[model samples]
Target: MSFRLTELAEADLECIAAYTAKQWGEAQALTYTGQLTHAFRKLGGTPSMPGSRKRDDLAEGCRILAVEKHLIVYRHHAGLTEILRILHQRMDLLLQRLF
Candidate 1:
């Protein structure tokens, strides 16, 4: 299966990088970004892996997978997965309207 990042997901990544850089440092930001990219590849390779959890509130096929302190939200379909957002684990997903 193939995976793609939605525009919002891409924007989320950018914002994450910027925030991490400001709060921590450039190196940490780059490291987290790299981790996120690796997580995306893993999701593409095995989207139904055990650790990923279903999100019924989001939609029929929505799911969330964790990578360290962050969460990767995505929707899976026939031949591809669409990454919807990347958010900090502590953030209230409901307040963000992730559902």
Candidate 2:
């Protein structure tokens, strides 16, 4: 099945990039973006993985993950999974927790 990332997800990445750029320069931000995108793409095929989350407040139909030090949120619908957002693992992950 094909997958798409939500606009919020894209914007989340941009926010990270901007933050990282201000602190570590654009190169690091771009590099981190690449990693985030890779993880997002890897979300394909498997509807859910061991460290993934399914949030209700955001999309009402979403999935998520806390990989490394970052959080990747997504959703699978009609055979297609779309990433919703990405953020620091330490960033209020309660919303993405498996509770």
Candidate 3:
């Protein structure tokens, strides 16, 4: 059950990197990115691993996984897991039109 990042997810990662780099430093940004990537890989290996919660409003198989202060939104389909977005926990996902 391999996973892939969607275009929006990739853009979210880039935005997170940029924001972390500006607020903290390049090192912090790189470290955080690595952490997120690790989470992605883990999910790829175990697509059914319990997420923070189910998001039926988003999609049939949509779920959210929490890594630190961020939420990894993904959906499982046809043996592939598609990452939908990575958002800060404080962000209003509904208001952001993530669902």
Model 3: runs farther than 4 Å from truth? none
- Number of clashes recorded per candidate: 0, 2, 0
Clashing pairs in 3: none
- Against the reference, the lDDT scores of all candidates come to 0.87, 0.72, 0.86
Regions of model 1 farther than 4 Å from truth? none
**What does candidate 3's lDDT look like per residue over 32-79, in tens digits?**
999999998888878767665788777677889999889999887877
- Regions of candidate 2 where Cα sits further than 4 Å from its true position: 54-61, 93-99
C-alpha lDDT (0 to 100) for residue 66 of candidate 1: 93
- Least accurate 10 contiguous residues by lDDT in model 3: 90-99
Q: Tell how far residue 4 is off in model 2, in angstroms.
A: 1.7
Better candidate by TM-score, 1 or 3: 3
Model 1, position 8: C-alpha lDDT score: 81
Candidate ranking under TM-score, highest first, comes to 3, 1, 2
Lowest lDDT 10-residue stretch of candidate 2:
90-99
> Per-residue error at 99 for model 2, in Å?
20
lDDT (C-alpha) at residue 41 in model 3 = 88
